[model samples]
Target: MLLAQRLPQAGTRPSWPRRLRAWLPAVPALLFLVVFFVVPVVEILQGGLYNADGVLSTAQFARMTHTPVYAKVMLTTFWIAFLTAALSVVLGYPIAYLLARLTARARERWLLWIMLPFWTSYLVKTYAWMLLLSKTGVLTTIASHLGLIADTSTLAPSMMGVLIGMVHAMLPLAVMTMLPIMQGINTQLVQAAETLGADRATGFFTIFLPLSEPGAAAAGLLVFITSLGFFIVPALLGSPKESMIAQLVISSVLELFDLRFAGALSTVLLLCSILVFYVYDRVVGLSSLSGDAPRPKGGQGGRALPVLLAIGRAAGKLHFHRAGRVPGNRGLKLYTWAAVLLLVLPIAFVVPLAFTRSPFVAFPPDLFSLKWFGAFLSSAVWQAALWRSLAVGFSTAVLALALGFGATLALSRMSGRYSKPLFAMFIAPLIVPRIVIAVGLLYLFARLGLTGSDAGLVIGHTVLAIPYVVVTLSASFKRFDWRLDDAAKMLGASGFTRVRTVLLPLLASSLGAAFLFAFIVSFDDLTIAIFVSGGLNTTLPKQMWDDIQLAVTPTLAAVATSLVFLVAFVVWLSSYFKRHSY
Candidate 1:
């Protein structure tokens, strides 16, 4: 039988129908992506090379790059992104280190602290910074009381404030990305170094730091790419002088009414981002982008690792410390806590400030009031947007999870050669900037008459949510026990019965968690909403964005507070399922 199985049967050909049946599960997701994601991106990129009459032209591109102000904006965007990425690395490394060294239970506790803020709405977090940095806000009040500056001091709407907010937002991502890498490092090597008459500093510098560089590089890439396309933080807390590529792309449409120019700029930004992403993927591998523990094969970075380790050893030779309480360790821990404090401060102040009786967004309330909360509950505009957001969010989550789960099943049965490209396709949306996705989708949806409709918004959110859902469900699928399926088959259970009674039951938690994540992502999405929804299809984030632009009302704080609690509750529920469902 083994020999017969290995030999080709005479007059036999592979069954094309069977092969097609195997591919069927992947077709829906592939077709959906082709029409929605791929088509829009093609339209946006190709639009840059054409004129208003639909004729091919490079005149727009020439004009855009040749303009002095536009060129300056490009340079400024790069500078800010580079600075933010570098700073996030410096600030987040200590926290990642602390997390890596802690016991498993302690790591989980601190991880929740980092991830809770990560799961909160970006707009709410930005608004929290505004409340703290405004002229009459908490920071200014403290500065005045301490005689550090005048009572008129204000940090909001300044480049300084933008940097602060940007860094705060980027730190948690940096830390989480690096934590896996640090955890993968072998502590035994460091102990070996210490036993060879080297101190803790020397062991870390020579043995640990070099091993952790890939993670650091991955963190830097994540932060820089995200910073390049920032909209909410800079839009709310930054001035015109600090405008980024995303803001410019938006202004080109809404303010200048230059769709061609916006398309050209979007193309340029997208190309630059893709170029960077390609380089990072080549250097670090795309696996890191999925938060995988990178196992870098020997290459240029590996060759240079020895040189870095030498430098570390040299630095360690200059510092001698007694074994009792390693030198600077306590100070390092202190700095780690300080960084965590800065990361959490913006989120911590929103609820308290929302209840303040004062009309302005000031801290330590002069009195308490529930009027802001009442306003959010009673106002037609707020209620309508809230309901629309919930509806769209629910739809997006279900659609994404369904598509993602099907794709995951198909991928599991595929050969590595086929799976690799499919995986990249699924993850591409996550790597691309939201600004680019928004512009492309807007252009395509307008042509299809889906713009400003709930269907359009749901489709947009589903596109954004699919990558995350795929990542989550892939993990669950991989962990699934095939032996149980075999047992069911042996017991005369059909494929559908096995899936219903076994696989579904086993993966329930993962599916639920993925659904919740998708919902939160769609609910908090402001960039896509800005392009696809308005008037009748407004989401909570879009409403908040408009309100912030018009005025920082107390009611906005109430909305932020409400969203924070709502999202926190959902996240907590997801975590509960994740813990017990498996």
Candidate 2:
């Protein structure tokens, strides 16, 4: 009894041994991030502050702060980001609203429509736009005939074209982000407002709008951040005079060979991104981005809520549509369907162009043939790039799945205090602009003699792919029952044996999904690969980027078509495996 009294109390001090055991799984992932992610970022920062001779200096920042050209480019980038975010919200809001209000079956169908373009390659989508807006392209020729413009030359490489392409690429992301929050909103509350006295428009403006602020904020943040790092669309669609910040960063490194200048540009861009993220976090909380934020408590709206409800009720007597069969407002359907069409129009335009034999990117070709498809498959250059992409994608998926699985497992066992910060660290790469990450990695890899090598591309792609793996696996892990493993342990099973017998079998489907997601992410990546990959290791997107600059070719159209089929098949396979997992 005296010895027991002298010992520490059971809850007073945590056991170090238990804590260390829980943290052990996360060590490998944390170390991987330290070497590949954090160290490179630090190197970029140091490069911005130091000279080539290894002495501390700031002369390299001359272009960013002192040059008028850099300032103009930065402004243009911000302008585009702002406009893109605003436009996405405008185009996406109605569809998201419709999605939230529709029946389950309708919602699934419309959601599939929105997600189809999202699954396709970004470069391919941009190429589609290039074809549509080109001199002899379908839309351009029709517009010319209709007196909309003199020719396609007026629109092909303009700022308007860039904005259109960017919005098309980003609208799905905005809609997806906002849809969850809108769906989570208690429809009953809106109905209660209607039953009391409110109309649809008034209810939407006063009640729904205010509550959806968090989702709106998140959507805007995601769109703007992605816009800031856009390279392929702007480079392909916009004129030289209208280059964005990312274009300048690329030029600084690839054209000028000015590593220090490129580092400075990246640091500035990174700082801007961090500042925006921090402010948004403080106001709305990062949980909004994941669509899991807690609902606000009731009775806090005061007199304003009831007053708005009264106005809505007074307006409720006036019916807007007499032919309505859908459950929600009919007026919204017009805008929502138009937005959906806008989203799919480029896809509709590009798929048929693959078989055309007009010798140019003309729609409704004079003749149809399989010539381009054969050319893409047979050409040594195209074949080499395609093989490289497949190899890198496979390696990236394996590495990311391994690391992300370890991190997710560790988090599943971790307490709140340790898990949240670690989770943020894991996702930081996603939030940081890709251009900044690419430039930083380029500097670090060049210094370590890893540039132009398969190992380097794999490492870079893994860093990009890991976040998706973590997100997918974490959700799956949370849904899983760990008690099965405990029961196995109770039966005298070893740790590895429990994992192999219980966890792995149960999680096999999720593992496959995560692997495919990583593969697609690595395969679609162009921003990072453009900066990191070289002549020998050129990936498909980089090859296409080069080809586009030289001339628009039918082979590109064929390749884009093939990528679509590939992505769709993978998605279908993933779904089939998941359904059969039981």
Candidate 3:
């Protein structure tokens, strides 16, 4: 009888208190983005408009476009990224397919194969490439010995070699990002097409291909962005013809010492990368590559051959269950083993090269010595850079971790769809080339007298590493149970105490992994460190970079060997701590 009267109620919108509760978690993140991300970018774009004379001018901008070299270099940068992205897509897809389709145990074992080279230092990884592709390097000597090439000159520095090494560096990341998405796809979709008389080609093109495009495009985006900022790989392994924007940026800074022009150059490089990335997103939506299957068994990559024929074998076994029917099972298994070996070949050259007595790299060494190691450890120039690298690396890690945690913690409790969008905003630095961020920071910092200083390098690196921390921490956050925090609050705890005692304790693995990963990324970085720090704070990677370009010797190899072990140790410790924890 009172139904009509009940219809007069007012709007049920959340009150200010509820809105405040909902928005609280976002405050810290918003503040950080505004301060570090937005401000730096604004200053960078505005850099060319002003000069050291305290007056505005277009001299820097005019200087940038006056010559065709930068323009050519910019074009070169784009194509390299495109080529690198294409190469990674081809090599990474098959490996990712294996990991996604294979047993859980196989997946674990395969990751060791995927990660062994990747977990090694980036510069060390590049040095390993140096050994494999040198004039008398392992690959060249073998090809000549087998009469595959006329001489060792065939494998010497060129664009092709640069692309190959860059692909090697970028492939692991592409596979890791793509595998999970591939795993999430149900294996049955392709089988259904096959049973409907769709042949292998038809099934792949119409069904699986469209489904997996998101991961492919995303991985491609990542490769392209990362490749744009590549300094060490090309600097060490390629010749002058392949000089990229990163090389140009470094020249403007170190060679020319024209801070204004260098900042302008960085601005251009950054803009071009963003333009290409924007086009990629227009072509393929990024959100589609969001998820994938987690660990399967034995490492998923170990069953490339067997995943081709699971059902029949599953029926044959008395205990057959999950993998009852999959094709190419045995062949897939064989292929998986081959895949692992293929991944290892490039980096495996280091073992022999390290022990060689030749001052320069050679195959089937006539001698062995530890002299290089001794030199690497004792050289004042290298030792100073090494110490500097550790200090900057640790600081960069801590800074990134703090910024990431603040943002992630604020974003974690948000209930609105804005959270996803906010997370994407935080992810912008990663997808945009480091060239852009570095340039932006260079321009901004110079005005503040921070350029080429330790503080400047720290700011630049932390900008890059923040995204790494955010990605890892976000995953940990998604898995967290809110009840524990609530439980802590109910028992009488302040927000900081709850975070310290409850949140931090629960996220130890994520924190540790993020820190180590952040350190690795910052340590391995050469592009930003090169321009932003000048020679004042040469990170280990930048030092190796200069050493490689100036000359290659056993001393570089000595440094490479030590870095390999350092990186491997950290990764092992991270995993160990994860396994031992609750």
Candidate 4:
């Protein structure tokens, strides 16, 4: 009778209480996201769909459609974003390929250069570009000296300048995304093709290129989605005609005081972003972004093989052939060096300008001085902003790590049916535009009296930071040997003891990496600070924005240089932990 009772449940599911208990570890993170991210975003979308009297209406959306200026801005935003993604992918592919071919140690050395701009503050990079692209700036002066253009010609305040800055900002991200996929490609496939009488160019084009398409496509999608919400680069580097939808949304709120209209604009952007994300998820799977090899559907590559082979034949025909000869490696190395130079040139210029004696931010200083650094050190406002950023960044790192660790652990134990959806939910913050999150939180925080408070800043930054934490931790957890926990348990260790001794020690490197990423995300944030800080309590990035808008001086350069050093120190510390963690 007891056997019958146990066997009789063949068609039945687990009890509701049992299922609920299974998800208990994830409850805290789920609740946090629901309260801070989902609820606020829904409220913002609702605001756009209703009038002041709370009656249902679409007047705001109607206004958006009917206004020619708004229409132009939407078109411009998409166009620029599309171009940025396309160019970033194209330009980053060679670098990713080169890095993929290098030895691990050599690749790491090169990656430091690639990631330098990524670690530097976006505001700092933008300002450096400003100095470089200005009429009398370094690039223009150099070009004029070489007779590349008239002495008065400049790059800034134009679409060309906007593209240059945007592509520069996104190139590192594209390379990082593609490099993993490229590295995973089997070199044997190309060697086999060459052994079968195919030339090197033919083998690379027919086999390697097709294999790397997924990575390139993934990189393009990510860059495009990220570029859609960019306001800082466009606002600073381009003219009014180049205004993006994000800029418009900011204007509607701060300048026009039209919350309803701003909500509508954000809604349009949110929907577009969601649509793109949906398409990417269906085609490549969102898991690709987190380092999973996306499964290509059956017959997908078969359909493209013929076209690729044809292209390969054409490429082979164009290759210059000589007896016992192959192309030189020096061209690839030169291209890589040039790309690295472009990435570091702006920061290199800004550092020197920071130490210049001139009050003006000139590239070649007449004399060296430390007055700008002194100014930054002595200013009460700068000190407060720096401290505020550090505090919020640390708090955000702790909170995000706690939530992400629990959620990731819970997900590891859950079934795929339950876990995949939850994983998607966790990473959704990354897909949604920062401006949308910022605008939604601004409304939610205002009603809760949390604006201008440090707690509010921490919460906002934590929401953004959690995705990074989850991604970093998930990669480590995927490869972790869970049997260690079982071994500890078998030795009569309790849950807490097993976690403290077995899990923590094993995962220290990943934990440190996750913590550093979360901290950097919060530290470099400007969108959330602009909305949640309310100008009264500013973070470092927000303060920099205010200062830059008010006046451009050597002081800004000094601040940028300081930030570069801080990031360098943080990176060095992370490396130290990694080296010693074992």
Candidate 5:
């Protein structure tokens, strides 16, 4: 009774055990980051500054800098990134603006349509594009019939093919980034501008465009940064000229087995990303980008082309006959069906080919059996690898969410001076190429005996995932009300009690959101997983990548389909939970 009274007394010191108890939940996260994440990066930095024996030196970096091949690869990476960034912005901005301007119903429907790409696995999307655009693909057959491709081989794979495929994969990301800010734009402001007699075009360019600039730039930065280290599409669907930094890094580490050179190359890629970000910040003001121009009071888009299309619809209605609607959305139906078929065909190709009576993977596969799938599914090597990949993805997701939550909390708690730099530091991963982080992890983990371990794979993925989690949670956290804490404390709550009962309750939803988002990010993650998981720990995406490179098999196709269904199911579950919970 005396001790309890003293504990509640003013200015009395808290017991050490109680404070330690409060910290227990956060300990696992802290330990994981320190041992796996922090150590790996430090190792990479140290290795880059030293030789194999670990003596400090800059010889490796110097050699890499002088190599003309590095210069060429760097240039190629830049050009491809720039092009992809531009295309993503071009395709994404209009849709984002439309999403912003539309009614809730229209916006939801449009967004779902845009998100259809997410329904397909990234691997499938790329492979499908290959089939759709390949010499023996549907495009080839049609082109040949029309005498467009005199030589079928010309359409197999090329620089342009890689560009098209990457753009498709990247466009959805660009749209997502811009959608939030666009939704916040004030329509009344635009109406007032129109009332002041400004033309729509003039008002849009002067007002709306600048307001949406920040969102656009952020989206563009995301697309550009991700494009810098693109590997799969470039390797499987592109010519040598299209090789990106990711492909180069993979070759250096795996084929050449030279960790030193890989680390140096990765450092260069990261430095280049930092340079781009610095340049972007200087050139484009981030604030004006998030704002939006006012919407007109009257309905928008009264353009001539739209009117002509409307007229055509009316005429077709008036000319209604037995065959009144021959094209009855037939054009759109054809386009949609064609795209869906093309998107799914590659994986579909692998299924039958896997069971092909013929040993060689070929079209018009005579084989129609499940032998390969059975062999792959039954093999201990594959079974172990599959389990390893699943474990790595989940562990990475957990690691990412923990650090992201703490960092975001710390960031939210901070104000003014230290804020910008810390926020920027968290944001740095967005632009820093994966090659840089991968190399860093490889070097760093090797010192700690973490290489070829599940711990290393988790660290690599967690690092890659942190930026997204931070960005997502930070956006939500910034809007959170701190008054709730005050309210809880006024009602007789202590710091711990307030956090648990008040803060955590409010943030629980966001935490869940962040976790699921992080999970998908980790699941789809290939770069860090590939680099870090040397032997014992292999991720699904990495395994899929190996199979693609070594031999494209139908069992791989089935794997791709399974992965697709998994992602889609998770997304659906998330959506359902979001609706019921939020």
Candidate 6:
């Protein structure tokens, strides 16, 4: 009776210490982000609000508003981002749709091709576009030979070039974003619609399209936000008139030496991104990114449904009247294959160009030679950059995985209102622009005397990598069978023993994948490296950026080709392990 009285009641709340203990595991990761990510970003944003004397003022914002060039640049930035998002969605929808119809194995195989461009370094891809769109390049040569144009002065340094590069970069992402939602859709609904006297077009438009809207919306939002911070594509392929807000921010810092203006520019960009994210969350729900259908809120179905249904009815009316006719499948397949080809073309072109005897990066070599590859191998600068990238990537992956694993595990064990907000906080890095983070880190690292150091690069990359790690582990945890743990516990296994023998074994593949993703994120990073390297510590991407800006040579192509092969091998090895592990 005394023991029963000593026990807490069923409805009694846990003690404060118990609640605090529940959050203990997550504290390290939370503190890390608060210190490195949140503090730096907040400080930079605050910089924009204060004057040179540290007095709070709106002069920076006033300058942006009053300056015609700044206003034009901001407008141009949004317009380009909007177009990139729209085009990526439009071009990627069919590919995602085709993949959705395939079997799991086939889908996985096709995704290999789709993900190649995504895995390739942005610098490599941008360089490849430069080669293709140059005056004496492959495409221009072909066009010239075919008598399509009288002038052969190249198609680059134009908005068309900018769009091509940006869209190519973003298309794979769009396809990936929409694929999960499309796969979760019930094709049976489309079949039912067809059975009820609707044509194929009508069924797809009314049922499948409506169901896929959330994914499309999510992709658009994500792509637009990502595009806003793009400096590489525009800098390489676009003229000054096509300069983006990111370019202006870069110029303000590097060329103008105006930290205040850079901060103000970053503030505007950050606020715009946050505003867009907020609207997307309220409307489509950010959960759409995870393939979950959002609950319909009030007024969600008001006019959009009627408009979509009307479009479906019109498409149905225009359908060709033929028995057993499955329209668009063949076309979709061909389109998907073409898209795959586009994704691989640049990488394919770079490989052969790496072996060219010519000094320049041009297609159709006069003779084959390995001189450029030899140059790359023998150059101390190149070797240093390569090793530095590997080191930073390794460090970033380890740090991110450790932090993400602990935080994810803690969140998985807890069930409360706090979980959602914490998860959102963890993933905020993904939503925020990379350029903003880069500039912010530059400011913070400068004050701490950590700028231009390997540690700075690792810290910045880890911030970027944590989001990918958290998201990957979160999904893996959700799909895990907790019953195994329960069974092990009932069998008298200790917590350590169960985790070591059961949980770790079951989650090994996911952990490896998350590590690989984090590594790749760090390795492929240029924005952070550009700001953090400070010309003292050069990463592979930073080296490539310098070479591309100063001089484009066959050696650059050789380096790019090597990176492609390395990334491909890594991806293949990962796939092999995953396949054999099962």
Best by TM-score: 6
lDDT of 5 by residue, 1-582 (tens): 344344335445666555455345435545655655556555556656778788888898777668877767778888988999998887667667666766776565555545546545567677666656777767667877888768635465777788778877887788778887777766677568658864444345445565566677778887888888788888888888777777777888889988777776676666677677776565553332223323332553223335444544454345432332322335434544454444344545544555665555556677676666676789776777778877777887777887877677666665535555655655555667776777777766667787778877776778767767777677667677776765665577877797678766777767776777677777777777776777554777777777777876666755765666676566665554444433
**Could you tell me how far off, in angstroms, the CA of residue 155 lies in candidate 4 after the best superposition?**
0.6
Q: What does candidate 4's lDDT look like per residue over 96-197, in tens digits?
A: 988988897788778877877777888999999898888987776788899987777778878988999999999999999999888888899998988998
The digit string of per-residue lDDT tens for model 3 on 63-125 reads: 757778776777787798889989888778877877887787668667766776776766777
Q: TM-score for all predictions?
A: 0.91, 0.89, 0.82, 0.93, 0.79, 0.94
Lowest lDDT block of 10, candidate 6: 2-11
TM-score of 6: 0.94
lDDT of each: 0.82, 0.80, 0.72, 0.86, 0.66, 0.86
**Candidate 3 overall lDDT versus native:** 0.72
Candidate 2 lDDT over 1-582, as tens digits, reads 433334324446678866787787778888988898988888889989988899998886775778888888888999999999999987788788888888876876676667667777888889988888767666778888999987535566888889988999999999988887888788777678657765555566567866777787788998998899887888888887669888888898889988788888888888888899998876666666656554444636433566756655554445521332222566678777888888877876676778987787765655578999999999999999999999999999999999998888888888878887888788778888898888888878888898888888899988888888887787678778776776676677976797789988899999998999899988888877887888665999889888878987777888988987887688776665556563
- Model 6 Cα displacement at 238 (Å)? 0.7
**How well does candidate 6 match the true structure, expressed as C-alpha RMSD?**
3.5
Error of 2 at 81 (Å): 0.8
> Which residue pairs collide, candidate 5?
43-444, 190-294, 211-291, 213-289, 214-289, 350-554, 356-367, 357-367
Relative to the unseen true structure, what is the C-alpha lDDT of residue 88 in candidate 2, on a scale of 0 to 100? Answer: 92
lDDT of 6 by residue, 80-145 (tens): 999999999999998999999988878878888887788899899999999997787777678778
lDDT: which is higher, 2 or 4?
4
Higher-ranked by TM-score: 3 or 5: 3
- Indicate the residue-level lDDT of 387 in model 5: 84
lDDT (C-alpha) at residue 450 in model 2? 84
Error of 5 at 504 (Å): 3.2
Better of 1 and 5 by TM-score: 1
Candidate 2 to truth, TM: 0.89
